[model samples]
Every structure is written in structure tokens, then in C-alpha cells.
Target: MFTEEPSYDVLKTENAFLRARVQELERALEACVPRESAEEQHHVPYRKIFDALPVSLGVYRRDGLSVAMNTTSLELIGGIGDEIIGKFNILEDPSSISAGFVENFQRAAALGKNVTMPPCAYETAGSTLATIDERTVWTETTYVPIKGDAGIEFLVECNIDVTERQKTQKALEEKHALLQALIDNAPMSIFANNLEDRTILVNQRCADAMRLPPEAILGKTPRDLLPEDRAEEYLREDRQVLEKGSGIEWESERVRDGKPYHILMTKFPLRETNGKVYGVCGISMDITQRRRAEADNRRLQEEIIRMQEESLRALSTPLIPIAEGVVVMPLIGSVNGTRAQQVMEALLEGVSRHRASIAILDVTGVTFVDRQVADALIRAAQAVSLLGSNVVLTGVRPEMARTLVEIGADLHGIVVHSTLQSAIQYALMY
Candidate 1:
């Protein structure tokens, strides 16, 4: 009670001074804490990160010491986690690394930068295995300086497994190669075209058939390679397929390198992934030989018909009639210009051979007689009349007579008989 109540002004000054000093210390502490350290700062715990990683991960020191390793990393290295943490030198161990790997790591450490490498096979426990950790094995290995209370403590190493991705990439490459081979060696001329008939893909056979390299035909339409009139026919067919969304097969005649080709073309509508018709796919086969054979067969068929007609006409011509010094010729079947000529020749020869006084021409079975037949008949009668033989034409249908008159057939010196018997009786009576 006697000592404590004396100095109130001093106590107030001391208390204010203490509060100001505390504020100053707090500001100093804030100033002393660095926002970002120039030295490498490991904000995330490396040990915790390594242990938590699903894939194998390891840390290598500058001296090639295995400073830290996860469970998967230790198992892949053929050692327990505790055993490999301080003992394994990934650079010096040939069983775990490829040639020049140590040199590459040393170079990266010296340059204080990242260096990437190609994949290499490593031997582990007398068996060759592919290293899946690209960061530690094949890809870029970064060496960053880690500063701690102990100076330049460790070199942070990361392992990234890229095995599954690499395998998929390799499989894709092989598929691409196989597809290229199939396109190159295809038998027919396979081609792809746009809606405008411009070519997009052409197989080897197509290039060869066009007498050009594959590069020359790319992006070219039939119009670019052929005459405009010819190109229009091809483009028309292609447009039909695209518009109708159907397949078309046709024969195309092409001229390449001054040689003619008969190409059997088949075109189908090409659809996109969304089921929209984008273009057409076409295959063409060389059918020159087959076309030639077909033309030859047609010619032979025509020749056979001509020969058969000649045989029929020859057989149809009657032998020279001997009875009553007269010859009778009966007409049958449809008569055309060619058969008409044959009939006239056969009749004239028969008249000359018989030297008959009367020649009877019958036409009861004749189907139709045109101007050509009427002209041949008139000419034959004139020829027979010149040979001292009177020509009597029987079986004159009313329609045929009108047609003959309309066609201006001259029958001034010819005798017309309605029946064959009437002609024969007239000849015998005369």
C-alpha cells in the first residue's frame, strides 16, 4: 500500500512505449518472411508426394545416390523400400540403365537444365524390361537445386510412367502402315471423289491406269484429265450416285497414252460418320479384252443370221418346173431388201434354165410386201419377159395391189392371175 500508488505518469508512458514496441516487432516479423525465395523451395512435401503416387517414383541425389523411393519404385528396382533408399546408384547400375545414360544425367546436372532421350531397354534381374518411368528413364530429367538449412540438400527427381501411352501409339503406327500397304497393292483401280468429282484418294492401280503418278492426279477431276465432253459423262454418273445415294455400275471408254481402254466402272455413295452422303467411291476394271470379245461375238451372230437367211432363201427358191414347159416360184416369209435381191436372182436363173413359155409367181404365204419387194418383183418380170418367157403373177391381194400402185410399180407388160391353178390352166391352154 505504501509503495505501489506513487508513479502514474511514468506507468502511462511505459505502457504506451511497450504497445508501440510490440507493433514495431510485428512489422519486422512480417518484413523478414520472404514472399518467394530465390533458392528452390519445396512447398509440397516430396516424401508425401512420392509415397502417395500410384506409379513408381524415386529421387536421385547429385552423387547418384537413391535418396528417396516410393513402394512401387523400390519394387520395380528389385529391392525393398528401406534397402534402396540409400544404396542404389541409378546412374552406375547397368542392370537398371542404358549406355550413356549416366553421361546424359551428368550433362543435365552440369547445365542445370532438362534433357530428354529416346526409349531404351534396361536389364533388371537378368531379364530385359522396358522402363515405363519416362521422367527418370527416357524423357527429360530435370535437375533443380533444393536449398535447405543444409546447403544444396538434394536433386529432386521425378518418375513418370508412359508405357501404356507408348504401346497405344505403336499400335496406331502399325495399323497405319497396314492400311497403306492395302491401298498400294489393291487389284482394281480404287478411287475416292468429292461431290464435285475431284479426286481425293487414288490407289496404285488407278495411278498406273491413268498413266500418271499418284501425286499428279490428286485434287483433279475428270474434266482436268479428259476432254470436256467426255468428262461430262463421268461427272453425270457420279452426280447421280451422290444425289440418289445409291451404287452405279457402267462401262467407260478411256484413252490414255494414245491407247484405248474399256473400263468397267462401279461407283457407290460414300457416307460420312454422321450418315451424310459426302462423295463417291469408285472401282474400275480394265475390260478391253472382254469388250472386244463381246463385239466379236455380236459380229459372228450377225454373220450366222445372214448365212441362215441365205440358206433359207436358197431352199425356198423352187426348182425349174418341167410340167407344161412352165416354172412356178412361191414366195414365203417376210421379205426385206436382202431377201428380195436373193429372190430376184433365183427367179431369173430359174427362168433362164427352164426356157419356159410361162412363169407363175405365187405369193399366198407372203406376210408383207413393201416398195422394195414390189420393185424386185417388177424387175424380175422384166428380165423374164426379155428371155422369151411370159410372167404371170398370181395371188395378188387387194391391199398389196393398192400398195404397189401407190409405190409406182410399173406392170404394163405383166399378166395378173388371181390363183395358181388359173395361171397353170392359162399356160396349158395357150
Candidate 2:
């Protein structure tokens, strides 16, 4: 009976499985070997099995000369000959010496223990001659010292390339440092507090605002340093953030030295990598100066309004000297109690200042007159009379006279005229 040879696919699958098993053993060996223990002796056939595996491995005598090396190790040395197999000394190699591998191997041999160094730069002559890849390579190397019955026998060296991983880790560290610098020097007050109410982080502005040094602020709760009310308020807001699991923006107030300072504050929930809420992060900016500016603007507006009203009141009740001894007061717009009082005061003041004997009040421009205005006019007439000047009412329409009668305003001693021209003629003739 003839047996069929193994299929190519089956042989390929077997080869792959063997390779995976060898890699697994490599990792297991790395873990099982204690760092402080000398390596136990292995059977001679085991070295040939390790040589068949696809990794760089070699055994070196205590004197640093190569005793045995795998095919992969021979390939890494750039050639296979007496110069590589037995004469190769990693300690004497210029590349290994410069790359720190030689020192690590020496240390392992001296201690009679295993030494592992990760992400170190090591380049082999074979790799440099073969490829156009990076001149510098990164690796995680392991050195294991083998001991025999007599003393130290050999040192096993293993290497694993990790160039990409090292580069990625370096980039992440650089980015984290940049981000930390930005937050540390930010302009606004910023803080992060854990659920236990302990301060985890604070920026320069936050320290300045609290009037405390950074060393004193970190790792402490707000209640430890801030005022009672303020600390309570911060805790309350933090609780809100935790409950909502989201961000909130609001304006708040802080009192210092009996003065109120306004602040715009933003708070949000901080979460862990697993998406669980852990704490609250907050940022605040002082808006006291902005609010003060708004208040000042309001006061300025009120002042402008007051000035405008005064100007209009003066225009509405102008007292003009029409003749040598006669003065005319023209009343316009709807007359109110306040304007009537002003009218009385202005008439008296004009009489005293201009020294006019006759005062004529023209009400033609006045649209409406109330009882308060009629009383005010009578009072103004009485006041002018007391100043030794006579008051004549002119341009009194029929409607105004009816309104005066209806209001029971007694115009007993006051002389009346139908027009301002008639009043002027009467005052000049008198």
C-alpha cells in the first residue's frame, strides 16, 4: 500500500500553527523567567528547535563570544561564517555598544539574572545593508543569563521591534504636555473637583481669584478655603451638574470687601473613559466691570433725560419782555400740576429779575387746562401781584373760559383780554 504525501495546504497550515506556538512559547518564557534568577540549563536539541523559530535569538559565552545562534540571529548579523557564528561578540560590536545593549548584557551577566529593556534604539549591520528603512530602530530586548554546573555558561538575548508603538506613545505624551500647559496658563478661572468634593485641578486664574496659592488649593475642597456661603453655592451648582449629566451656563455673584462682583460661570459634568460621571468641571469669568459699565450707562441716560426735560419745560413756559414795563408768559402744551408750579415760580422770578410792572399770560398755545393748572395760574397771578406787578390773562378762548367756570376757578381781581395784541396795547397805554 502507497501512502499519499501530505497536501501543500496541510503542510502550510501546520507550519503556521507551529510558528504561532513558538511565538506563544517565547512570550511564556519571557514571563516565566524571574528577573533575579539565573537561567537553568536546557538540552542540546532545544537550541536547534529555537533556531527553527522566526525570531532573533542567540546564546553568548560569559566572555561575550557567540556560542550558538539561530538562523534569524545569523541573518541579523549580515552573514553566516566563522566571523559571525563563533567570533561575534555583542559587547565588542560598535552598534550594540552605542545602542546601550552591550551595557545591559554586561549587567545581566554580572547579576546572573534576566534583564529586560523596552523601546531601546538598536540597529544591526544586516538590516542596514539590506533595507532602506529607518536608520534607527526601536526594540524591547531581554537578556537571560544561563548557568551550568560549573558557573555562568551563556546569556540568551531576545529582541522585539516596537518602533511604531514607541512613536505613537511619544506623540501622545507631547500632546498631553501641550494641553496641560494651555490649561495651566489660561485666562479664566477654571477648576476640576471630584465627587468627594476634593479639588483635583485649578488654573492660575482660579488661584488668583481665590487669593490662594496653588499648593494650598490643590487636593482641598472649596469649603476649606472659600467663604461658607460661596462654598455652599459651589457645591449646590456641582450637584446640579452631576444630576443633569450635562453642561450649564449661568451668571453668578461673589461679594468681596462689601462689594458685589458679577461672574459668568460655565459648569459641566466630567466623565471617565467608560462614560461614567465622576466629577464636575467649572470655568468662570469676572463680569463685574461690564455690569458696572452698563449701570453707568443707565445713569448717564437718566441724566440726559432730565436735562432734556428741563430744557423742554423752560421752552414751554417762556417769560418774554414785550414792552418797557410789560412781560409776556406764553403757556403751551397740556398743563399739569408740575408745569403750573414751574410757571408760578418762573413768573415770580422773571418779575423780580426784569422788574416788570405788568405781566401778560397768553394761553393760546395751551390745548387743555385742568383744575390743578387753573389753581396754579391763579397762584402765579397772586405771586406776581405780591411782587408789585399786575397779571393780565390774554388769548382766553371760550372753551378755556368754560373749563375755568366748570372748575369753579374765581378770576375776581385778574383782568382778561381776548387777544395778546389787546393786552399789549392795554399794558402800554396804562
Candidate 3:
């Protein structure tokens, strides 16, 4: 298996630590086995450090005879190394050559120095190295060439297990790729800025919105990409979001493809695992069509309101020229303050336009007579009188007469007729 290079310093530190601990153990072992046989002393090297090491280790000759392995090495290989350590020869073993581990060992011996190998996974097959797992065992190994006056001597193979770390790294990489894909394919413009207000991430829509490539936008501040005024507005919003640790929504306008667009923007703070607000993220949606539709609707609504007002004005004070020097205005529905004012203006204008001696206000269609309605009638009549026109009130219902009197409406100068026919005859005669 091929993997990223392991740290060189870590391997060297492991070797140095092992050597120091081995020296201490070798002193103690030498004291215990004094006056032993040459054969017994010959086995001293492996016995000196096997019990003291926590790392998997093996001592191999340059020609590739495995001299010894520690207790940890036996445990690392799933308790199978004890049987093979003294018997296996890596340079001659078909499995070792096939696994290509022999090349690294031979390289270390030729250089007469230590070499740190990249991480590798080994199968627990009929190979010289047996590791316990239903899956391949991942490890990083460093080969140290021990030299003597006779030239290169033994090779120390140190192995560090990295199965769990490799799995964690792979999982994180997959998740990152998934997240990137999601953002890149999103419809709305999405972006994130770091603490320095530099663009850290921008999705496909964001790049397209700016009419720039992703590489052109990344790592650049808004000022670099947009006009100063617009960039400052964006920066200010970002600063506020980061400071408040909250979100804000607002509408703004921009031009794209030579056309103006209204966009609704939402900006929020991005938090780290520790709950610290590290940056701001934003998404902008183009609402150009919606804004245009709303504007059109407003214009339509205003036109409708204007048309209704004109119709009401016409109905409120309809001036009919019954004959020369006569005009009749029919007051229908309820008369409010605004309609009353219109009534007075219409009557005076009608009197002048027809050169009439009298103006008749027919209240036959009036639904109810209140103090306000009576007052409006009185005020309108008084105003028309000033224009040298007499306002003759027709359709004077008994209830309206009571209301007019109770409200103290002074109708001294104005003529009151019970019917429009009588009012018209009276106006022509006057």
C-alpha cells in the first residue's frame, strides 16, 4: 500500500527513545547473566531490549535473516512473529519480495543510514509479516542501518501503527468533498468571508452573480471586486453580523447582464465548534421579477383608486341643467365631510356655468340624516350663497328636517322644497 509520508522527526524520536531505553535494559540484563556461555551472550542483543520496548521492532542481518523480535512485535503481528522471527529471511522470502518491503530494507543497508518509509498496509496472508485484522493493517516503518568497524551490521526495522488515523483522515476528506459539492450546485448566490473580510468560499451562483470566475473571487475582499460604495456597504453589514453573532435580512439592488435586479440578502455569522463567531456567511436571491410585479400592481391599484374617486365625485354631486337658469344636484348615499365640500364647489360652479338663479340639492336617496350630514348641507348651502346663487334644498324628509333643526343649522336664506319638481319651478321663477 502507498500512503503519505510519515513525519521524519517522529520516526527519529521513536528510534532515539528506543535506543535510550534499550541501553538501560541492556545494563540490567548484563548484570543478571554474568559468566554466561558465548552462545548465551550471543543472544544478549535481542534479550537486552525486547522486554523494554513498546514499539514493534525487529533485528535483521544485511542479507535478511531475522534475528529477533520484541514481545510488542509479536503482539503487533497478532502473536505470529515468535514462530517466524528466527526462521524467516526477508531477502530470500517470496512474500517479502512481492510486498516490496525488501527494497526499503536493502536501500537502508546500502546508504548506511536511517530511512523513513511512507505508510503502508500489509495483508495477513502467507507473507513474512503477519498482522491481525479482517482488513489490511496500516503502518509506518523506519529502517536504521547499524554500522560497525566491519562495515554495515544489523538493520533495525521500527514500525508504528496508523490504522485509526488513516481512517479518520479519509472520513473527513469525504465529508469535505460532499459539502463542497452541495454549495457549488446551490441555486442562490452563496459566500463566506473570514475574519479579515476576505472571501474564503464562493459558490457557483456567487461567481456567476459577480460575472467572475471562482478563482478570481476567492481570497479577495469585496472592495477588490465591487465598487467602493457598494463594497463598503457589504463590509459594514458583515462587520455587524460578526459582532452581533446574529443574522439580518434586507433588500438591495444590483445590475447583472446589463439589467438592474432587486435581490433579497440574508447574512449570518458562521460559528466554529467552540461556538465562536469566526466569520459571516451570506445568501442572496434575485427578486427582480417579484419587485417589478409589485411595482406594476401598485400602479394598477393606484389607477383603480383614482377611477373610483372620479366615479364617486360624479355621483356625489351630479349637476343637471333642468332649464336655463336652473340646475339640480342629487345627493345620494351618506354625505361625509369630504363629499360635502365637493357638493358646495360643484353647486357654485354649476350656478355660474348655467347662469342659474337657484341650485337644487335633492336628498331623496340619502340613507340617514345625522348632525354631521346636516352641518355639511348647511355649510355647502352657505358657501354657494356667497357665489350669488341660492341653494334650494329638495327631498327634505321629516327626519332630516328634525336633524337639521336639532343641529341648529341656520337655513334662513336657503329655500327648502319637499320635491325636486317644486324646487326646479321655484328656482326658475326666482
Candidate 4:
């Protein structure tokens, strides 16, 4: 009828063209929509698992905008699904911005890789929908980038709360710092060693005394750092302390700066709370000057005592020459056996030195004479007679005469006078 109804071959060509166009449109529509693939379907179950995790997780767009968040992530940000799904921007949100989440996200997106950050404080915004209070918490966050055909598509943020752990770690660090300051600044030499004789700790003074750094001293035994003989002695002493389970104070010699030193060291066993000995601790002080002073004092005192004894001996005996060819020796104080011998020696020496023909022995100053003194006087006279001199004894008081008689001391061959004047007169005449 009208141009053969557009020919059969042309109709078939048009139909085929229409079918191909419809198929092209369907492909475009499928690409435009987020179609689920086998791989994407595998990720679906993992998404559910991630949402149930205790850690906060979120999928952020490459533009730092939140795309989807788990319940934990939503609770961490104190926001609802609608508030965060399409409207939340990490850079614009007060909580995430303060937490530095936006900067971490941008870095992961730009680098198209994972970015991890140290612990940081995350502050919550005051909102009624917030699960947590408006307080700061310590968190360690990591951002992982999701890749697509156009490069990075999204960033997955994972946050871990470490508030309690960080608090405990900070406290321990502060205490350690304080203890280290005390140990370094101590005045005395202090050290600790293990049971195997390995050095565990040493103060600054201890290291300086040993002529080594503190770090160099640790883990080294006394045998490694000290002279061989000294190390052996030190180890023995330390072992005794550990075995005794008590503290001991002893003096030992130490060499430092090319000089010898006397050290007073206090050593004790290092024990645990259960009273098991693990090692030993020691504190030492330099006592070289004090010991030297003590030795010097002893020598000085002995010298003073010797000088005083010499002075006393001189005062106890005196020799006097009263007239020509006459000599007199006077003895005073208690004449014990020792003093009697000294008197005899002095009289004989005086007679010979003066070449006296007559010798007078005086006892006038001798008070409270004993039998020993009487015997000593008689011997003096007899000895003078042997020297070819006339011996005359004087000052024979009644009490001394009684003592001489009681002791059966006979001076028959010796001349006896009542006073020193008589004895001197008689001796000069003879």
C-alpha cells in the first residue's frame, strides 16, 4: 500500500538496531546503579561483622565526608544515622575535628594507603543523642583507603579507646623518672648486683668511683670491671651477705684516682616480698682520712706518755754534793723493788763520778718507808764502802728504824746518824 510498508529487509534492520540500543541502555543503567557483584556480596557479611565489633568503624568518602558508620562509630561520635550518613563532615564536625580525624582521613585518601596515628584525645560534643558523656578519651585511630577505578573511593577509619591503658602508662613513667633522679643524685656510692654477680644498678657516684659510665657497668660482674684480686674478695664478701640474709658493715681498701682509700661499706641481701634473696645491695663511704687521723692520734698519745714517764723518773731520784770529797743521794716517795734498784745504780754512779772519799745516804725525805726501802738504804751504804769510801747513813726516823729492825736488816759495818747534818759532818771529818 504505501511504499510497500517500508520493505521487509529494512524492518528487520530497524528491529535489530532497536534491540542493540535497548541493550546499551540497560548496561548504562546497571553501571549507574551500585550493582552487587560476587565480590561485593562476599563483603556484605564482613560489613555485618565489622558493625558488631567493639571497635569504632566508619566508611568516609574521599572528600572526608562520612558515608556509612557502624553502631560503635556512631556511638563514638555521639550522632544518629541520619545526622552522619550524608550530612556529617569530619572537617566540620566539632568532635572529629578536635580529634584530628579529618586530617588523618585526608592523608589516607591522598596517599591512597593506610595511615596510623598515635594516641590522641577525643572530646565529645554535648548532645542528648550522645551515648558517652562530654569528656575526653584517649584513642588510637587508623585510616585505610578503599580503591576504585578512579583511584581512592573511600577511607575506613578504625578507632581504639586506650584511655585507661594510657593513664596507667603515664603514671609508671612519672614514678620511674622520679626514682631515676634520686638514684643519680645520691651522694654515697650505691650499687646492686644479681645472684650471678652481674651488676644490675649503680648510682652516678658508684659509676664515677669505679671510673666507668653507668651504662657500661650494668650487666658486668666485679671480675670484669675490677682488679682480679679485688674482684675475688668482693665476690666472696657479697656471697656471705646473701647467705647470711642480713646486713653487714666492714672496712675495705679501695683504689681510686691512683690513690688508696679506706672504705666503710654496708652490704645487705636484696630480697623480694617473699623473703627470697635475689641479689645484694651495698653502700660505701670513704673513711681514709678518718682512719689516718685515728692512727696518728694513737702515736701522739704514746709519745706523750713516754715523755711523762721520763720526767717522773728524774724527779724520783736526786744526787747532791754538799762538801769536799763528800757525796749525798736522797730518795723520796714509795721505793718499790723497781725504784730500789734505780736508787742503787744512781748512788754508785754518783760516788764514782765525784771521786768522793765519804758517802752519805739520806732518807729524811723518805716518808712511810717499807721493809723494801730499808733494805735498799742498807745496800746503798754497803756498796759505797766497797768503793773505798766511808759510808754514813742519816735520817733514821724511829718508824723507819723499827721497819729496818723488823726486817732483820743489820747495818753493823755502816755508820748511822740521826740527821743529814750529822752524817755530813761525820763524813767530812773522817
Candidate 5:
């Protein structure tokens, strides 16, 4: 992390204000002027505090020739106050010339208007002088005009070091630029709006979604980009998020590029440190493809279910007519409770529909019979007999006979035949 700027540079505030009020110094202007001897200057009115002030201060004639230097100024110039006093001229200083003081000299120094110059490095430190500080002093200098009888008589010079403050401000600008880059490159649409319903922030993705650039999108309301109905709906949702001070999510449909898309949107309140809602933030993602895939999967599942039911129906009760009063029921696959029930229904229905005297069930293709299958067969025979028909079972396998015997199935009135043809012949003879 970057180091924070120190509060040292702020001392110049008081120095600049009090140092420039030359009217107070005007009372002692005659006395404060530098004399031939240094010992007598201390006795001048307001001389003690003015020299002891913490900032760099100097007095110069309207033409910019140095007249006097404060205690701080003497320390910065090094060696002795008598050495550079009245010799240094601000108009000839390299930093001041580059700062346009040479061009604007009269209006600033000779006139009554005070002017504060931009921050610049001063070479009066250890560069040429024998001062203690080895580094260059960066300072903001101010020239205040002191007025008297005919016109402006003198100018008061004040300087404040501002090196750290300058660096801190530049550092903050760099951090803001870096954060802006990251937000612009994000994939999803992100935006925020103030309580006035004006857009305060928007990512590049959101701007592109609205078919506008970031600058065009910001400071605009929902109605600026959308139809009246849609805009009102969006604003209403934003208000809800702010009122609730919580997040909400839902799916909505939006049209883009002449096609409808599903958007998964979420809105939340942006709060201050005091927990007051200031604005609303929103995030949205396109989910049209995902929604389409889910719908396709549901259709496929329904189709598969229909196909399975058809296959089970075809497998359960397959029937064929053999003669005018006889029908044949062919059984196949392993029998379950549901399929067994279908078999019984088919047999009774066929006997009544055909006015058949016999319903022959061919179990040649049947797998091993369980108790459920055995019970289904007996019930079918009894039902057919009640419908004025006789039940004949043909082609019983050895396993089928053994299972029926083991289960002690009671098929007392049902007739048995060797094959489907023989059962049909017997029914014809009857």
C-alpha cells in the first residue's frame, strides 16, 4: 500500500494568512525596515514575532530586490542573514522566471493584488547555500502587496513546502485509473443508479448491451434507453431494492438483436458507512441459451415417456383372431403385476367383443411364471367363462408347469391344449 501523505505541509495555511496581512505591518513599516546595525532591528515594533514566524518570509521593493529576510529565511539561505539580505532578487530566480513571475511581475508585486504561485522547487536550500537540509525544498510561494501613500510600496513574500501533498494527489489519480480499467473489462452487465434515478455508474458490458458508449449511458435514466413501460418496470424494481435495503433476484425476458433473451437479474442497495441507502446496484446475465436447453430437455423427457408407454402396451396384451368364435392371446417377456393386469383385461374384452366361445392363451414365448402371473391367468379364465366362453391355454413350457405346481395354482375349469393351432381346432369343433 502507498504511504499516506503527512500533515506537515498543512502548517503553511496559518503562515500564508497571517504573513500576507501587511496592513498590520504598515503601522510598523518605518520601524521594521532593515537598518545599518542588526542589534537595533530587534527593538522595532512587531519585529520579534515576524522574524520568529515558522514560514519562509521576505520583504522586497516593488522592483523585486530583496530588502529583508525572516529568521526562517535566514536558516534556508544558510550561513548569515547579512550575507544574502538585499542581494537576492526573486525576479532573477530561475524557478520564478519559469513560473511567469517575470512577465506578470508588475500586476502581482507592484499592484495591491496578492498572487499565489504554483508549487516549485527552490534552490535556496543546500544546493548553493550551506543549509542543513540536503534535499531541494518544494514550495508554493505567495506575493502580497503592501500599500502606502501614493501606491503599492512593498511586497511580502511567503513560502510553504508542498512536496508530499502533490505526490499523494497523483497517487490517488493512478489508483482510480487502474480500478476503472478492471470494471470496463468485466463480462457481465453491471450498473448503479442514484436516488434521483439517474445512472451514476455503468460498466462497458452494460453500455454495450444498451447499444451506447459509457459516457452516453451515464447520467441517463431508464426511460432514456428503454420503452416507457419497460423503463417504469425497471425503476419500480430499483425503488423496491432501495426501500427494502436488501438484494432481490428474478428472471426476465428482454429483446436484443430482434430476438428474445432470458436475463437473470439481481438488484441490491448500496449503503453508506452509517447504513443509509444511497443508491441501487444491479447485475444481469444472459440465460437465454440455458433456458432453451432446459426446455429442450423437458420435451425429450416427455417424448421418451410416451415411447415407453407404447412399448409396454404393445408388449403386454398382443391379440390375434383365429376363427369366427375364437381369439388367440400371445404372451411374451417377464410378467409384472401391471402387465399381468393388462393380460386379464384384454382376454375378457376379446371374449365379449367377438362373441367368442373360446379365448386361447399361448404362453410358448413366456418366461418363468411367478405367483402374480399365475393369479392373473386363473382370473382371466374365470372371467371368460362367465362371459359364455371357455378358456384354453396352449404350449405350456416345462418351467411354466413346474412353477404352477410349486405355487399350487388352482386352474380347475380352464382347458389345456398342446399348441395354438390345436386349441383353435378344438374351439371350431365346439
Candidate 6:
């Protein structure tokens, strides 16, 4: 019992030694364990940030298994822990949200960079549940990578429903195609030009008529297709139309390939919404056939005139004697210059032919007489008298007498009577 009395000092010494050894080991272990630096401590809060994001946020390991996800991500995937943990594959379907998505994630991890493909098509069981019809579900997806203390991590994806927008765009494209078809097939030659007088658009008819492709004529002015002189005229007219902001109709002759064409052109000043004239629009009609017809008609008219004059001259020639008796030429219809000349010629010829003692000019069938008729009658009488025959005129109306007297026609050598009966009686006396 007396020997154990020295135990307090020994116990104290042993306790001190144990304390020192424990302190040295704690320092060694502390140096080997590698404590988190300030940067790592700062990034500790990033996990909360990723989990609290509104968009579907996810952190995937390089092995294609989802390591973590936010609430929205979990909701989008239908579940978080066992649902999409490691069972999901990436290459089965390019359109599958869980399928090709892993491939994109792996690519980002490999490059240690961010990659974005144009909104890719994606499908998933979770998205399928949201779809009304099982046939189709359209979504646009995006993938991102996050770099932190855990090294580069892949984001699963966030999908946005774009079915309506895609459908609208497709419908618009279809409508545009249909409208272009109508414009191309239109009957009339529709066209448009820019302010610089360059052709911007032309339909098939216009291109065909110009003997050029629609593309070939683009950016070309009328001057390029028209002759220099004609181009100048067209430019002047177009300028006037633009200045006046009005419409004009013009007829012009165009020669193409050594052939002439008559064109009826109507031009209108093209205007903007503000009513400012920018250029001119025109429509042309080929009137070559009409012009040819008119020319032919003119030629025929001249020919008819020439023929009538020749006939009048032939009738005006004096006739030779056929018998020793009177020759009768009964005047018919309204006698004008030509007809009257014929009658005079026939009368003189008859007088010469018969060597008749008397010549009677009958006008019973004549409707009305003019100064020309009276002149022709006087000429006939004078001619007959010169031939040594007594000339008598018959069937003279009062109006005819007045007209002849007013015209001062020399009818003194001619014997005039109101009826053919009187002339015949007078001739018998001769």
C-alpha cells in the first residue's frame, strides 16, 4: 500500500505522453486527408442552386447515370431515384429524351465543353404522359454541362413543346407554295419592277413572250430587250407616268427577230401604301393581226376606187354606128359623176351609131338629180348637137329644173320637157 503512493506522478507523466502522441498523429492525419479549399467550400452551395432551378436541371456522371436532379427534372422524368438513375440508354432513339440524350451528354463530357444542337426532337415516358394523343408528341430539347468540384458533369435536358409552332410554320410554307403556283400559271403576263426600272418578278407568260427565263430577265430593264431608239421612247414615257402618277395607253410597233409587231400597251404608275409612285406597271397586247387587216382593207379600198374610175372611162367612150336607126340608152338609178358620164357617152355613141335624125335622153327611172346630173345632161345635149342630131331631154321634174337653173348649167341647146311623152311626141315631129 505504501509503494503505490508514487502513482499520481507516474499517471500524470503517462497521461502527458499519450496526449503528445495523440496530438502528433492528429497533425499527420490532418496533413494527409487534404482539407477542402475555399473554392470547394464556395462551390458547396452550387448543388442547392442546381436543385432549385425552374428548368429541368440534372447532373449526370460520365457513366451515363443521373447523379442528381432538381425537382422539375424529377417531375419531368416521372421519378428521380430508381426511374432514371442508371437504367436509361442513350442510342436507342435519337428522338427519345432518355435515349440519344445520354449520347449528347457523353459528348459534352468528352470535350470538356458546351455543345448545342438545333432544338432536337425528344420523347420520353414522362412526356408521353403529358401528350393527349399517343400517335405524336413534339418537343425541342437542349443539353448543357456543369463544371464543379466533381469535375465536368452532363445535364439531362429541358424540353419545350413546339408542335403548334412547327405546324404553323409548315402551313405557312404550303400556302406560300400554292400562291406562287397561281402566279406562275396565270394567263396574263403579270410582272413587277423595282424603282431602278429593273424587272423583279415576271410570270411564265411574260418570260415566254420575251423568249427568256424568269431568272434571266431579273434585274434587267426594258432597254435591254428593246431597240435603242425604242428603249429611249419607253423610258421617256415611263418617266412621265412616274412623275404624273397616272395611267396611259400607248400603241407602239415593236420589231423582234426581223418581224414587226403592233403592241397596245397600258401603263400605270406603281405606288406604295403612302401613294408615292415608285415605278411603272404595264400590260401589252399584240395587235399585229388587227393592223394587218386594216392595211389590207386600205389597199382594197384604193383598188376599188381605181376600178370604178376605169369603168367610168370605158362607159364614157363614144360608140360606133351599128345601124341606120336611133340608139336608145335608158338612164337608170341616181346618176352621179361616173354614171352621168357613162350616160352621156352612150347617148352620143347612139346618135353616131344610128345616124338618127333626133336623139332623146330619157331619165324616167332617176329618183333625184343634182348639179352634177344637170351638168351631165347639158354635156350630153351639147355632144349630140355637135354630132348633127337634134337632142331632146325628157322626164325633167320641177326640182330638177330649178336645180339646173340655179347651177347655171348651159341647157339652152337642149330641148327640155316634163315627160318622156312630150319628148317622144317632139321627136316624132322631127
Instruction: Give lDDT tens digits, candidate 6, residues 222-252.
Output: 7887679877886887787777778988788
Sorting all predicted structures by lDDT, with the top scorer first, yields: 3, 2, 4, 5, 1, 6
Best by TM-score: 2
Q: What local distance difference test score does each model get? A: 0.76, 0.85, 0.85, 0.83, 0.81, 0.71
What is the Å distance of residue 194 in model 2 from its true position?
1.3
Per-residue C-alpha lDDT of model 5 across residues 1-430, encoded as one tens digit per residue: 9997757557777667777777568768868886566646555657787888999888888778888888987776675767667787877889767776654556675456988877876555334555533365677778888887857878888877676776676689989888778877866789999999889989888988888999998898999978999899999999888777799999999787798999999999988999888899998888888999999999999999999886777667877777888888999877778888888888877778888888898888888678777777778788888888888999888877877788887778799998988888888998
Candidate 5: Cα lDDT at 174:
87
Number of clashing pairs per prediction, in order: 0, 0, 0, 0, 0, 2
Off by over 4 Å in 3: 1-54, 91-100, 110-114, 121-137, 193-198, 220-250, 265-283, 296-367, 371-397, 401-430
lDDT per residue as tens, model 4, 169-255: 888999999887898887678899999999998999889978889999999999999889989988988988977889999888867
- Model 2, residue 53: C-alpha shift (Å): 8.9
- Tell me the TM-score of model 2: 0.64
What digit string (tens of lDDT, one per residue) describes model 2 on residues 345-401? 889888888899999999988888876777788888988898888889988877788
lDDT tens readout by residue for model 1, 1-430: 5776758899999999999999999999999996766434646675676687766656678778878778766665578867777887867799446555576666666666655445443434542453443323322333454555755545655445555666677789999888767987976889888877789888888898678999999899998987798789778878888777899888878786799889888999988899988788888888899999999999999999999977877777654584756888888777778777777788788877767788888877788888878888788888878888888899988878988899889897789999988988888887
Tell me model 2's lDDT, rounded to 2 decimals: 0.85
Backbone clash pairs for candidate 1 read none
Query: Every model's Cα RMSD, please?
Result: 9.0, 13.7, 17.2, 14.2, 18.5, 12.8
Single out the weakest 10-residue window by summed lDDT for candidate 2.
35-44
CA lDDT, candidate 4, residue 293: 98
Model 6 lDDT, full chain set: 0.71
359, model 2: CA deviation in Å?
A: 3.7
TM-score between candidate 1 and the true structure: 0.52
Model 6 root mean square deviation, Cα atoms: 12.8
- Which window of 10 residues has the lowest lDDT sum in candidate 1? 133-142
- Error in Å for residue 126 of model 5: 10
RMSD of 5: 18.5
Clash pairs for candidate 5:
none
